[model samples]
Target: MSAARSSGTTRVVILGGAAMGSFCAMSLRDQGFTGPITVVERDPSYARASTALSAAGIRTQFDTPLLVEMSLFGADYLRQTGEIMAFREEGYLVLADAGRAEHRARLAEMQTATGAEVALLDRAELSRRFPHLNTGDLACGTLGTRNEGWFDAWSMLTQARARAREAGVDYLTGEVTGLEAQAGAVTGVVLKDGTTLPCDWCVLAAGAHSAPLVAGLGIELPVVAKKRTAFAFRAPVDPAGLPLTCDVSGFWLRPEGQGFIGGIQPPPERDDHPPEDLEPDHDLLLDLFWPNLAHRVPAMEELRLDRTWAGHYEMNMLDQNAVIGPHDRFGNLVFCTGFSGHGVQHAPAAGRGVAEWIRHGAYRSLDLGPLGWARVRDGQPLSEGMVF
Candidate 1:
């Protein structure tokens, strides 16, 4: 596959080489962009990359139509994971209690309108479909019957990186320390080792560290790092046929290998800002997660904790959704950060959209207008209720 010739100079410098960066590079190549694409990554091992540490669930059960549409594309993209990475269609079940029944129904209407394969299941239907679950306190549930599940995100990222490299994309190991901007347009990026890489276009995809990087350019993105922990446990009974179930209490669990992996959303008032460390929070698991699991699944009452790990969500505090597209001021600098945990699933579509924008000066495939930074600048945040 030969790279497409660009109309003008298009030397792109991506600040992160994880899932989003690699996928963006692949998308550019796939879209016939023959520009020099350089991806700068500090950690090539991806030991702490959010894509490698994510729960890796993909679904179309979003409250907004745009999100549903993006995730639907993501699910279809993951269907080809057999050639790129490992994937499984175990399905996802989102439970809604009486308090959120109306909201859940509204979301279901929107999801169905967007061509999502989601069904609103009553309590009896939920129990019939998932007998292992305890749906006694639920009013209704939204179940993704098809094109939804989990996959090995690390494998996908690695495969994408390898493909991008094979396609002539340069993968450089360095940390971007500064950006050189002239007359509101980025001109070059400076590495920590005092090396300058001049770029015609710059992309900020540094995950949780993107906020500080953009701040250096006088952009105020309301993105912060929020820590989320996933606990692995072994239940007394087999969790076969069990879908990734998210209870009304914001705690979610799913079958992983011979056991299960799960986590819970922290309370709204709780400060989730933690140090840049991936230390598992044992207290959160033993205190909050276990109790919720026991209440939702009685078999989990006798479950034993196997292990635990943590990661950061590049949370968009402005709206809990993604902030994509080019910057309002710097047209040459693209904004691909602030996914707030949806980066892994939406990377394929986002990368394609960004590549299209760079190639044709517009989003030719998926309409990502709703996720632009203009809304953030205007104080008009798009409401995305499904933030777990």
Candidate 2:
């Protein structure tokens, strides 16, 4: 912990210069850390980065209180600095069927308790609010009236990376091969070119590739890559009153200018897509999402499918929750990955939290202890109630 206080001389290295790594670098600087910082990313173009391929949705409708808090904080941070990210505050609406109505209503109450502006509506009210939606099968619905929407995720990442570099954080383009550790501290980072960069502190934010990077160190991180497909389409439904709506039929949709976008996580049996395979599966859009869209919003029955894309979600196998804070085995190595699909939305808060941990040896603003490495080490899963 003594090393945390010596901010002026602490050398830090971050892996994967995407959303998480870039945010952490900027936040570290924001926290008054004058230490030398370097962010190494394999792809400087970020063409295939998860941050660039996401559906770009943000929401504070989760059932977990801490996650809800993170969402609120991230939303505020984005609005404050998202002039170029196309920040949208349209909000998120989740529909519940008869069986899950009471449970979902309970979640809405919890979200409201956590200062999330949300409202619970019954079937009639849901129909009144979204007149085009086929609410005959819905028992109730929850709507986040504020701080819940989508934005351009790639823009956010790019801005953070640029800001970090402008603040004197070095942006290194390299393929990290492994970590060099001695005793309990990470001594250096080994690159694919056999170049080793010495560092006093290391942050692992490699997203889906995080597990493989640390596996040789005898650390088994449950973070893995899961393929998610999204489609953009023009529909008869009105985009004016629509929110990023999640239906009971296991699909979510939202407005994007002249058209709407929607997608779903593939079934577990077929979700084992190779991390390198990014081919869009149009069959799922036709067979799965279209039917769900037609069932939820009758207006979308005539929707015309357009361009589609596929990406990987850094899914935590043990629990769909993020793991942050100091690594148990290597004290100098802080983890800021394993956010499942919520990485893009939670990056701001989580990155700030990481900076706090590195600068003060404790979280100053938000207590992210509940999502620390101890749980992952002890096999205690802090699972979220549900994921979107």
Candidate 3:
């Protein structure tokens, strides 16, 4: 289909319709852009989309000031769930060991500077606050007292999709097979079904599947799929009101329905590139997560495995941070990919930032220059220390 056949306004083609793409379309409308926005998504069910598969936690506790600011805004956006979807403000707890005291303190300073309501608690305070946790080896921990926690990602995406459609955005079910470029700028995209979508701008937010789509255009995004698993279980005792807690060992858990869900990152040597199949490694949960949980929460020693699922994290090789903004050479082609594991929490700010840049030729709300593609192009890595 030609651009005119698709729609009759300033054309914008987004390559994915999950969290990032859906939010981008909504942001464009919210920014007074009455253009023909087409979101091309291969999987509308989003069963395999990162957003739907995520643990769906949002937080303002981050090591970097930019991430802290972005997530702070994201938490605010999520607080509108009463108008979007059901959400929780259960908060997040990030624990630090003795060796990480300095690092945690520095991050706490940055988070405070960004006006995040995060409190640094000593081991005694952590023990007193969450008596179930074993804080003997912990030096300190940061806890978000407000505007943090998990929510229904699919619900948010669904609401955003509906709002975008109501605002004249087009949802196209197709796969972008190739990009059509001229004079070092992307003019449009070609779908696998031989449909051509001409656009004034294109944003790639395809998550793990983004690299192959842009590789043909000579763009190398340092993103790769790394499998992470989540297990839902029933603890022997009720751990109600438990916050999303992260251990210094990388193990984490939080409340889910009547029970709890949690997981631990496999050791570096075992964190291999995930296969096409998203099969959960039950043994990893049994051998790793179970033991870790048992050690942290004595009541969890008798937890019963309810179920498990695996999802991919689009790991950024250079610095494990997001790469946003327009491509240096292809100015018309903007990027909102390589969010690593922060996509769901940072989607709102990122989408708004991208839309603002597209509409006003600069970021009007937040300065996201630190996450621009220029960092990758200039061989400068903006490493984010908080990867969990």
- Best-performing candidate as measured by lDDT: 2
Q: Distance (Å) between predicted and true CA of 189, model 1?
A: 0.8
RMSD of each: 2.7, 1.3, 2.8
- Candidate that beats the other on lDDT, 1 or 2, i.e. the better one: 2
TM-score against truth, every candidate: 0.96, 0.97, 0.95
Runs in model 1 deviating more than 4 A are 1-9
lDDT of 3: 0.85
Query: For model 1, how does the per-residue alpha-carbon lDDT over 118-155 read when each residue is reduced to its tens digit?
Result: 88999999888877778889999898888788888988
Task: List the lowest-lDDT window of 10 residues for candidate 1.
Answer: 1-10
lDDT for 81 in candidate 2 is 84
Q: Candidate 1: count the clashes.
A: 0
Q: What TM-score does structure 1 among the candidates reach?
A: 0.96
Query: What does the lDDT come to for candidate 2?
Result: 0.88
For residue 126, give model 1's deviation from the true position in Å.
1.4
User: Residue 355's C-alpha lDDT in candidate 2?
Assistant: 93
TM-score of 3: 0.95
**Per-residue lDDT of candidate 2, residues 1-388 (tens digit):** 2345445778999999999999999999998889999999999998888899888888888867999999999889888985787879888899999999999988898999998999999999988878988988889989899999899898899889888999999999999999987877788999999999998889999998888777767889999888788999998777975789998877988898889988986777777777778888778887788888888888788978788998888888888999999888788889999999888999999999999988888899989999998999898998885675
Q: Give the per-residue lDDT digits (tens) of candidate 3, residues 14-91.
A: 999999998899998888887789999998999888899998888888767888888888877877657455578888
Off by over 4 Å in 2: 1-4
